[model samples]
Target: MTVSALTRPGERDRLIVKLAELDWVFILALCLIAGAGGLMLFSIAGSSWTPWAINHVSRFLICLLMLIGLAMIDVRVWFALAYPIYGVGLLLLVAVELVGDTRLGAQRWLSIGGFSFQPSEIMKLGIVLALARLYHGVSAEKARLSWWLLVPALMIFLPVLLVAHQPDLGTAMLILMTGAAIVVLAGLSWKIIGAAVAAFLAIVPPFVMFVMHDYQRQRVLTFLDPESDPSGSGYHILQSMIALGSGGLLGKGYGLGSQSQLNFLPEKQTDFIFATLAEEFGFVGCVSVLILYAAVIFMALRTAYLSHSHFGRLAAAGTTATFTLYVLINGAMVMGLAPVVGVPMPMLSYGGTVMLTVMIGFGLVQSVRVHRYAEVTSGKGSFV
Candidate 1:
C-alpha cells in the first residue's frame, strides 16, 4: 500500500494496516543472524541442541513475538511512558547497588522472588527513550551549545555512574555511548564534541590505572599484548585469535574447529561466540553474518531518518547506536583488538538478558516505523 492509502481516516489505526506496516525485511535479517547463532551453538555442542542451541532458538522465538507485539503499540504510547520508564530504571539501578547479587565478582544483577535480572539492561532502553524525550522539546540552538545541555548531561551521567559503580563496565559503556549518540544526533556542537573527546582521552589513563578493578586493568593490558600470558589472563584473547586465524578462507567445514571443539577458546557460547563462528565457518562465513548485521543497521537508521517526530527519530537512532556498539565491541574483543569487556554479539550470543534487551529495542524501532506518520505532541504538553 502507498502512503496516501494509509492517510485515510481511521485506516492506519486498524491492526491489519499496522501489521502490514511492520518491517518484514528487517525481521528477516534478524532471523538470519539468530539462525546462524543457533547453528554455531549446535555445532559446538557436538551437534546436539540440548543445551545452548535450543535455549538460544527458543528465547529468540519468544523475543521475536514480543517485538511484534510491541511494534503494534502506537509510538505515542512509548513517548508517554518514556520518563516513567527511565525513572524506574534509575531506581532499580540504585536498588542493585544496595541489595543486588554479586555474580562473577560484579554487583550487577538483582534477585527478587528467585528471579534475577540486570537493571542496567532496563537502562539501555530507558536512556534512549529518556534522552529522546528530552531533546524533542529543546530548540536546536539550545541543544547545540547552551548551558541547558547540562540537564541532558546529568540525565546521562547519573545512570552511568550508578552502573559503573556496579562495575559492569561493559553495560555501562553501552549505555553511555547510546546516550551520547542521541545527544549528537540532536545537534550538539562540534566544539563541545571535540572537547569532550579530548577530555575522555585525558581521563582514560588515570581511570584505568586508579579507578578500574585489577582484572579490568589486566584485560586492557592483555589486549595490548595477548602473548604475554598465553595460559593466564590473556588466554581468552589468544585463543580467540587462534580460532579466527585457523579458520583460513573457507573454514574447517563446521563442527571441526579444533580451537573450540578441544576447548581452547573461552566463552564459546557467550562473548567469544563470534570466534567460534570464525573457526568453523571461516572468513567467508564471518563476512556473510556481518552483511546481515549491516542490513539490519541500515534499515534501522532508515527508519529513524523517515520518522516524522523528533522522538521517533532519536529513539530509533539511539537504539541502533546501542546495537551497533554491541556488535563492534564484541567483534573487536574477539579479534583481540580491544579488551574483553564481556559484551556479547546481540542475538548471536547465548545470553538471555542481552537478547531480550536487543529485541525490545528493535520493537521500539519497529513501532517508530509503523507509526512514522503519527504526530507526537511537544514535550511541554501531554504526549497525546
Candidate 2:
C-alpha cells in the first residue's frame, strides 16, 4: 500500500474517535428542553401552527445549523469580534431609542421587513464577550484591586443602564447579574463586592420610586401581596399557583391540563411556561427538568474550568451564568417568587430570536470545550 493510503484510514479513525467523544449530553438537554417547549407552544397556539410554527421551526433549524457551525470555529475568532460586536449592539440599542418600534409602551424592538427583534438579546452575548475579553488578560494581583477593576464594571453597567432606560427592567437586571458574575469569577476581591452591594441597597429605593413606572411598581407590590389585586395584577399569579398546585404529585397528564386547555393561564407557553409544565407534569417532572438545566450549566462551567485560554474560560463561564439567570428568573416569575418579568425561560420559552441566540452561545461554549486542550496564550484572537 502507498504511504498516503496507509495514513488515510488511521486519520479517519482518529477523526471518528474525536467526533464520538464530542459531548452529546449538552445537545440532548437542549433537544429535550426544546421538545417540551414545542409541545406546550403547539397547545397554547390552539393546535394549528401552519404559519407561526413554520417560522419557529425554521428558526430552530437555522439555530441548529449555527450551533454546529459555531462549534467548529475557534473561540479566538469570537474573542476578536467582541469589541466590534459590542459596538454594533450599542448602536442597535441607540437605534431602538430613536427609530425602533414602540410595542406595549417600551421601544425595545427593531422592525426590519415587518419582523422585529429585541436588540437587548444581542446585547447579552455581546456584553458577555466584551467583558470576558476585558477580564481575560488580567493578572490575579491586578484583579485584587477595586479601582483597577472598575473599568469592566463600567462596561457591564453602561449597557445595563441603557437597557434599564428602555424600561426593560428584566433584561437590565439580567445583564447586571451576568456582568457581576463574570467579575466575581474573574477573581475580584470580596471587599469590592461588599461595597457594591451596600451601594445597591442604598440606591435601590430612589431608583424604584423615581425611575420605575407605575405598572412596574404595582407589579412589585403585587408580588408582595398578590391577594391585594387577586382579580387584577395578581390574577396571573393566582391562576399560576392554582395550576401548579392542582397538579398534585404526579401531574394531570399531557394535554389534560385544565389551566392550559381551559385558557385560564395567561402566557402559558411564554413567560409562564413553567406553570403549564408544572400543571401537566407535576413536581416530579419539574424537578427532573430542573436537573437537566442544572446539568447543562454544570457542564458549561466545567468546560470553563478546563479551558486553557482566559478568553475561552471567561466566555464559557459568562455564557453559563447568563443562561442560568434566564432559567432562574423565568422559573421564579412563574412560581410567583418574583414579579412577572418578561424574560423567557431558556430553551423552553416561545421566541425564535432568543432560542437561536442562546443555542449559538452553547455552540461557542462547545467550541471552547473542544479547544480546551490547546494552550492559547495570546489575548488577541480572530472573531471569525
**Between which residue pairs do clashes occur in model 1?**
none
Candidates in order, TM-scores: namely 0.96, 0.91
Tens-place lDDT per residue, model 1, 1-384, is 889887866785687788999999999999999999999999999999979999999999999999999999889999999999999999999999889999878899889999999899999999999999898888989989999989999999999999988898898899889999999999999999999999999999999999999989999999898889989998999889999999998999889999888888889999999999998889999999999999999999999999999999999999999999999999999998889999999999998999999999999999999999988997543655
Candidate 2 residue lDDT tens string, 262-371:
98998876788888888888999899889999999998888899888888899999999989999999888888899987888877777886797798788889888876
Poorest lDDT segment (10 consecutive residues) of candidate 2:
375-384
Best-performing candidate as measured by lDDT = 1
RMSD of each: 3.9, 3.7
Candidate 2's TM-score = 0.91
lDDT, model 1: 0.93
C-alpha lDDT score of every prediction, in listed order: 0.93, 0.83
